[model samples]
Target: MENFRPTKRSKLELAAPVSHKNEQFWILDGNTVLEVGGVLFKLHRSRLVDQSIFFSHLLDERNVQMDGVVVKSDENGIVYHLSNTTPKDLEALLQLDKNPMAYYLVPPPFPVLAAIIRAATALRFDTYRAFAVKHLENAWSSSVTDLTTERKSNAVEVVVLARTCGINSVLKRAFYEMVRVAGYGLGDGEFDADNGERPQEISRADERRLERMREHLISAWLQVAVRVDRTFICPNQPKEPTAGTESRSSTLPKCPSLYSKRDAWERRVHDSGLYAEYKFDPFCGLQALIDIKWDEDEGWCSDCVHAKREVWRTMRQRTWERIEVWMGLDK
Candidate 1:
């Protein structure tokens, strides 16, 4: 076999025609048409260029001419082909250009929010990216207990999104939520299917940082456990009967067993259920332990309760100091 000639395909087979649809915030009146994922969107070129530096350069007349963009011109405007982006994502990014108040007033669903973040970040829309970040932070910042099942499920996505977009403000809380909902073995897929699946998205460096944080947290929890263990106050001893007045001139009331009481208290404080609660309630920390009251029937003395509370305060302060450091948010 010497030189061989390949058969050419028809234009229709080579490139299928895209169907245009009028979507939210983009219509026929728009100056530019963009075909994304087989769907066409009519939007203003100036609005996009103004919002994203990527678009500003990408759509520049010189670049467009040199790159020989696949475009079609009609009475409406010029159409450009955009590859590798879905129509939903492009719509989400364009929605940002509408009334700013609407974004906050009518919050989108988590899927829509994720799409907005992904598109904004990819297109280098700084303002839109920040807007997406604020919405994400607000959506999840409420009490974790109040989060719906769906919202709880999205915590891992939030962490990946925050890290990928360089939104440090949300990264700490997002990471904490992920660990709370997913546990130390986040890479095991305990929380979400996609969690830890995309190393390119989260990065090996970030994964290592998370592992270090887990180690620090384990150490902190052990410290808390130790503090809880040593919090019991030793009973006061009755003054030894003077040299030899009488072996027992006055009988002393019998004291409750300190060892047994201490054991019970430790069990309550260190229960796995309570520890799980602490993971989600980061702000509460050891305060949750202090809030626990001993049953009157259990015969727990006020002195021991007070001692436990004091120990909890100390533990909380220490743990708080380590939180920022472990989360890599100290800066």
Candidate 2:
């Protein structure tokens, strides 16, 4: 982090009297002044300290005899330089403090929301942090699609933001949502397609988390596939031979024919190139299998396809339920 130093006043300026003028409507009768990204804000120290532990500790360290360790003194009073925070972010935080109800009524855009979360986390503003998380959760849950337009674009950044702010629940959901839509392998260029703007790059540590999640999801799919192989039955199988047909029973029973149908279904899944597709794209694979059309001429019965689709649906639902646990986020 780079340090932003305030302008130094000459020794002659120390003897000059200081006068204050109201700049913004929210200035009020504030004793502490702050400069963020070249914009000045006149706000009360007590109000800020009360809301944020970080602010409380920071202000407590300043010497009151020196007018609370002035960073810059002018006609607008003394100002403290707040490094790395933008004017917009500081304004949003102050607005939330002044009128929280109004702020929550109309949520900010994603970029502004990200800035607010970052500033709130750094300043240790617990109330604002919780408020942001609640809004994010609402945004995520309101859409029924695998991933909403906003979520598709911002999910990656939100994962990083949630981890930084210590919002574990959001982090887990965001990660799961990303995997659900984007699949196992995501290239850097594909990230920008969700929104026109380029997304913030995730750190290598976060990248590893995504990789681990993809591995778990793939394992879950493979397990479901194994279960399907063991339990699926061919609908075309004939009933067992009735009574004793004697010489007519010399012919092979129908059990081999039933097994052959099952084998053919499995072979078609591989031969049609779906098996390879499923390895890279699990959700799409499940969808493709669900929509499969069986032809009588191809030795596949409609009843068999229907039964297989039902099994796939059940497995998919079960896999969804266990994803959070597999990712170590159930707690």
Candidate 3:
């Protein structure tokens, strides 16, 4: 055989398979080989099996090969091909899975949370999925009283998470929050937190909804909110004495008027955004209206202070309801 195979070899035959390892998660002596996005990850077989039943069955030693690749070349080798999961997601899962004790204490960042939920859901890691959902429920809380609660993810990210995990408890709140912050519309480039390197995957429908809500909110703000408290009379201001029923000496102390207060309120409205370049954040903006100190010493009685607080409270609730209607989420 002058040798059909002797003189030369093709690049395909000469080249070795290309794959990368994530040093952050690659464990020494890990028995299972997991691949995502052409990157190989070595994970402890028992640990993965312990975390998910799907992994347990998928990594069974009884199955020797998958798609012609030797899944278990021997007891020392075990390969599992993963689909519909990204490297970042798998990496997040690896981090979370390795430390079960920490999950209860340290909540992951938004990016990590998004990644874990997506991967855990696809991989059937139920524990991680539930944990992520609970954490997110707090993050996107709908309660106006909990406005001070720190949040790692914004409404945009929450929308993505809700769609991915099918969690609806926070969807309405998320849609409301989206209009509060985001001004982007269809054809605008959005940030893809799920895959930083990829283009935004947000649908045009989402953009349209936000656009409509934003416009409606502005209209509601101008028509209803502005008109609701254009004038606030101090509830504690003494009423005009009825026909001088008693002597002038018996007159109660008059509550001094804050002539500039209404002007200040209007200015706040302008500062927080009546239009584009809005600093309006319903969670903070509505609260800001109430934050004005109504001190009894400043001519405001306790009743007046209470009245101001109550007005803002009612407004906040009303805004939420209006948001539901604008978004077509209202029943």
Candidate 4:
């Protein structure tokens, strides 16, 4: 076609679901088992290569367990099964193949977890807001974090993407809890010492120092976002410096050094609503963006030129409210 123009956003339609009834033989890719009708598949160097000859390989009938699995269809009409397989098993299997399609089987979920998934896939803010409120209507009676933890039903990709989109506050809360549980706290909070030191309360002075450092880091992130694409800040990357960089020079300290401080700084930034305002710059004019650069010290001081700010701004307000409730901000 002449003068063909393509859409910017992904116009991918969800594919039709695959039926398991007619399928006989199957191959396991990580946690996902791909079954082909009356066909046996072999793992070739970790890949699921179809074997023309069918083998009568099956898990012991007694050993085959009944469990729930979540299935989602991709744009290419391929169904994926996702499961909460151990990170260890995932790593072992992933090394064999790089196709993201192979993983699909998932663990059973609580009802709320199902809702979270639907809401996230739809990218519906109202649905996300309603689900979170239903779970946290009585925020004072329970630990907000605990409420979040109980609903462990989504794939890591879904949860992380929801957080980046600034939708599904509950999912984001669950994500942060995972981050915290993994022992990666903000720069302003009490930190785990790698030197075998017992964790203790942090001094107020040190906390303040951490806040400044975190602001510098976040400011730096925004600069990168502007200079590069938003994809540069992948959630999968190491939050702290790598070993090689750490050895080269101590010019930059690792995140572990200022976890507590970073936490406090983030809290202050939240309470002050700087992130919300900066995320959605009211001014989009060229001059306004230039001014943000002028005030270099302040974070997002020049965010007015952000092309995505209009959408991000509305989402920011709603997201912050959900987060405030999740964190028990009234206290």
Best by TM-score: 3
lDDT digits (tens) for residues 1-331 of candidate 3: 5647566868986785556777877788876788777678888878888887667667677753334233434333545556668888888887887786666776777778888889888877998889988887877777767664243335666777787778877877777665665454112455544445544345667667777777766665554336335467766555555884754435544544565444444454554453233333454555665675645324455666688788767877777667666666654
**Per-residue lDDT of 1-331 in model 1, one digit per residue for the tens?**
7898899989988797657675565565677777777777777789889988767977888864424236667654677766645677878777666756666777888778888888888777888778777888787663333333232556556777776666666666555555544453345534334443343236567667677766665566655643345444434324556876664425543434666565655677555466655544433556666667753434466655666678667766665556677766778
TM-score of 2: 0.60
Model 2 C-alpha lDDT per residue in residues 1-331, reported as the tens digit of each score: 9999999989999865443333552466777777665566777888889998767876776633322223666666666766746566667676677777875588878766777778787777888978977887766552223532232457777776777767766665566667655542244654454446555556666677677767876776665443336455666555466677444334533333455655665766667777665663455567666766654444556666677778777766666566566666677
User: TM-score per candidate, in order?
Assistant: 0.67, 0.60, 0.70, 0.19
Better of 2 and 3 by lDDT: 3
Which TM-score value belongs to model 4? 0.19
Best by lDDT: 3
Ordered by lDDT, highest first, the candidates read 3, 2, 1, 4
Q: Cα miss at 189, model 3 (Å)?
A: 3.1
Error of 4 at 95 (Å): 32
Cα lDDT over the full model 3: 0.66
lDDT of each: 0.63, 0.64, 0.66, 0.33
- Which model, 1 or 4, shows the larger lDDT? 1
- The 10-residue segment with the lowest total lDDT in model 4: 49-58
Candidate 4, 1-331: lDDT as tens digits? 6997875654353243333421222334332343222122223322222211111111222433323323334432333233323222233232222332332233223333333433333322343334334433222122332332232322333334344444344443443333322222333334555644444333344334334433433443354223323332222224466766654335422222233433433554445454444332211211123333322343322232243344344443444344444433333
User: How big is the positional error of residue 152 in model 2, measured in Å on the Cα after superposition?
Assistant: 1.0
Segments in model 1 whose C-alpha atoms lie over 4 Å from true places? 1-26, 49-77, 83-85, 140-151, 181-201, 226-228, 231-257, 270-285, 295-307, 327-331
Instruction: Count clashing pairs, candidate 3.
Output: 0
